[model samples]
Every structure is written in C-alpha cells, then in structure tokens.
Target: MSSDSRRFVSQLAHNEPVSQVFLASDKQLRPNRNGNLYLQVDLSDRSGSVNTRMWNATDNDYKAFDNGDYVHVEGATQLFQGNMQLIATRIRKARPDELDEGDFITLQSADIEKMRTRLTEILEQIQSTPLTRLAKGFLKDDAFMDKFCRAPAGMKNHHAYQGGLLEHVLSLMELVLAVAPKYPQLSQDKLLMGAFLHDAAKTDELFYDRDIGYTDAGQLLGHMVIGVSMLDEKVRQIVQQDGQPFPERLLIELKHLIISHHGEYEYGSPKLPMTLEAIVLHLLDNLDAKVASFSQLMADCPNSESNWTQYFSQIGRKLFKPEKED
Candidate 1:
C-alpha cells in the first residue's frame, strides 16, 4: 500500500493527472441532455472527498463497482462551481492487494491516548460525589470507551473524522475547566459532565467502519434523545451496583443538560437551556463545533493564491484564509 508513489486525494491539483486508489461512494448514473449515459461518483480517501464523473461510461462500468468498493481511478482535476472536481477518464475496482484500508479512514491529528488521559484528569476534578460516580460509570465501561475513542462527532460537519467525538468532548472539557470559575453560579460538576456526555451517543449514531453514514437508530432517534436514555440507564446501573441512592434531582438535571444542549427547539432540542450549566454547555458545545467546522473549511480551501474560500452554505458565507507570516 505504501510504495512511496501513491498520491492521496488531498494532494490533487487542478489540471494534473490523478491516478490513485480510493473508496467509491454515492454512485449514480444519469444521462446528459443528449441522452448519453454518464457516471457520477464520489471518490474518497482519509484526507477528504472529491466528486467525479466519467463521460460516455456504460452501464457495465456502473455495475462493475459498488458504493463502498475500493477503486483505481485516473482523472484530471477541474474547477466545478469554483471548487475542485475530478473528471475521471478511467475507473476500475481495485484488487484486494492494491487496496489499503488505512487510506480510506479519516482520523484526528490529535494524540488519542493523551486526550484520553486528559479526559480522566478533568473528570477527577468533579467535586460532586454522585456526578463523579455517574461519570465513572461511563469511564469504566470498556465497550463504550472503545467505541467512544473511535467514533466521529459527525458524518460531514465539525469533527467528522475518526476519534472526533473524543477530541470534541476533550475540547469542551478544556474550555469548561477554563471558564467554569468565571461564572460562579454554574454547577462546575454538572457543566463538565454535560460537556462530556453531550455527544456521547454519537458512538452509536454514526457507522464509520468504511465511510461514515447514519445508523437506522440514528435516523429514527437522534443523539440528544438517545443520550438521555443512556444517562438514565447508567444511573440505574450505578444504583443497582452500589445499593446506594443516586440523587433523583441530580439525574433530572443531567438529563436536562443532554436534551437541551442543542440550545433551541428548531436545532432539535426538545427543551431550551433552562439551567445555568445547561446554557453554558450549549454555548461551549456550539463554540467547539463551529470552530472545528471553520478550521476544516479553511484548510480545505483549494486556492492557495487566494485568501477567500468558495462560499460555504453551512457557514452561509465565504471564509477568509489569511496568508501565513514567514
């Protein structure tokens, strides 16, 4: 897989020859105005994805590959809608020997082990006994930890890479630790716990083995609702294990934090942030996600000579990429 000759999807430049192995996705076939068949596909690697098309392709070519198949593509980069797109000339499914599984998974650049240790350190700072116990209930679950350490925060939006959920949570925790003191009325323990559990259900919401996609359960019930259920189940287990009463009021507040972290009803929260901790959790969570989204948008900007990226519908505006100072 590493011949020192492979070109990744991110390295593609305008009008250059591109020959590489990529995981194929979003396959569709349609005819031009002339009624000639053409293939439309998305080629992806760990770095990112690029939309591609093969003109004059036949149905056999379309049938030769599936959505998740690893394929070898020969194409040239072209500007489409002010962004880079690939105009493929040749495409074939890659043999098992040619496909490298590593090439297909996007990962966070942060050190996951260090992040995990930092998370543990932060959790230890929680002063409330019940909250501490509840947080530990999750930390002690090896099964959940394995998935949590690997799950992405989203499919395409902010922190949409392997280890993204952990990275995002850790980021929120760091911010809470820094700002919790400034606001004395906020419950320090609950605020930090909310940040950790806000997107914890994403471990199940997204299926990321090959490429990220929504699970049936995720489509049916979102992470916010699922997170409340998970928190309740954990509380029950804690009580059953210790034979001690877990505070019911504390549990309700924690559940509220998860359900209302989205901040508004339209954003999918069934309730708005009523508690100070919940309100703080919403703000910090949005801050981390929006910053991650903007950072990715800037990094993915194709034009090196230009400072402005193409208009992004998600951010609802084009971003300025300032030149680096030497």
Candidate 2:
C-alpha cells in the first residue's frame, strides 16, 4: 500500500476494514474452549499498537513469523470491553518489498541526534566533581550511548518507541531544572543526575530491534537493580582514572534514587523514597509518564466526536478530551 493511503492503528475505527503491514509482537497460540487454536498478537506502527486475534490458527501459522517480524494482516476493528482490537481473518509474514520501513519508525535519525546533543548539554550542567566524572564515564562509552539513545522507555506504555529513552530523560531533566528552582532546598545536580540514571538501564533491560520486549536480565533483575550495578561500574571507572575514591554516601544516594523512583512497593519500587531528591524524582517521573500516557490516549481515542474516551479498565475511568482551540 502507498504511504499516503495507509491507515495507522490510531486512526482505526470500529468496524473498519484493515489490510496493512505492521510490526508484530507478543504472539501467543492457545487452545480455545473447543480445542481449536487461536493466535493472539500485537500489531503496531509508529502511531500505536492494537491487540489482534486470529481464530482457527494452526501451529504452522504461528511458526511462520517471529515476534519481531513484519506481518500482513486482513482484519476488522472492533471494541472489546472498551478497548480497540482487531479480529483477523488472514495473517502471514510480510515480504520485504511489501511495506516501507519508515512507517514503523517513530523517531528519525535527526531527532535522535538533537536529543543526544540536548542530553550532553544538560549533563554538562552538573557541578559536583564526582557526579560529573560518573556522568562523563557513561557519556564516553560509545556502545552504551548507542543503546541509551535507541532504547524505548517502556514496552507498551508511555514513550514506547525507538529513541524514547533519550526523549524521556531529556524531558525529565528539563522538569528537574524547572522544579528545582522553585524548591531551593532540593539539589538540582542530584535530581538531574537521578533523572538521567533512573531509566538508563532500560537500554540493556529492553530488546527493541523491531518489537519491544524484555531481555532475560530485565525479567530476572529488572532495570532498577541493573541500574545500581551500572552505576557501580561507572563509579569504578572514575575511581581508577582519578585514583580517588568516590564518596560513599553519594553513591548510596544515587543507587537509592534508582530503586525508589518507582515510589511504592506495589509499583515495583524496592524501597520508598526517603530523601528529598528521591521523593521529587519519583513524583516527577510519574508525572512525565502519566502525561505522556494520557496524551497518547487522547490522540489514539477512536471516537473523535465523543468528549470522553472509552473507559479503560487499567485506569478505571474514561479520559476527558477538552475541545481544541482554533
């Protein structure tokens, strides 16, 4: 299909006929009540993803494509319990010539480069010598920097696209710069570093070549624990270069920022925010993610005429859409 004629997932409406190629992930084949197999998968593009189900699927059909493969689907959109999903009649692996790769890319190379430049500019604002050294260590690692610039901030929720991690960190750091001045007691340097490092390990935690998913380390240790270890590695490099020991208390505080940034135990934080910077980081992190999620929801809502979106069971309410000013 021509790019101009392509309809994105976000533009799909109820009862709409869909014939397009999408990057597929999270495929599962399971037996229904009648012992017939059904294929469940997520079809995604740069806009967003839609959960898809294809009934009466065979084992060969499931093996025809991998999680990261592009698939051509013939389906119809439907509302299932307040959510948009696709009921597919036919699905098969897409040929190389069938689709354009640009359709699946959310961030271009120029966008990533701009964000990388902004990230370096913000990290340069750190005044603490030890923190500066730690930040420099991370920046100098070309391999790590590549992944940091390319990894998604999440698998499905907010900022779930290539270069999303860098975008999120830059936005969070900007928020730190803005909010810290209002609260003079908070250390801007510490908070900025916390924002940079909070989700840094997600680069390693997620595998995002075509489809976003968790690595084995991410499933076993998670990004928070891995972040602490990453911080220690950078700190070790700094110590070896300067022959001066990094501050014990500062290292502990940085590690605490990563582990507690989730805020609550139910949210996967191992410890609650104890310090002023930690608490601020947690709150701001949540604020950024929620704003992004809500914004995406509004943009992706199918019923453009409705003032409120369909009720989302995850959040337990419909989101109100304010009318746009001309």
Candidate 1: stretches off by over 4 Å: 1-4, 30-38, 56-59, 102-110
lDDT score for candidate 2 against the true structure: 0.93
Q: Tens digits of per-residue lDDT for model 1 on 88-157?
A: 9999988888877767655534578778889999999898999889889999999998899999899777
TM-scores, all candidates, are 0.91, 0.98
Clashing pairs in 2: none
| Leading candidate by TM-score | 2
CA RMSD of each candidate after superposition: 2.3, 1.0
lDDT of 2 by residue, 125-223 (tens): 999998998889999999999999999999877999999999999999999999999999999999999999999999989999999999999999999
Top-scoring candidate (lDDT): 2
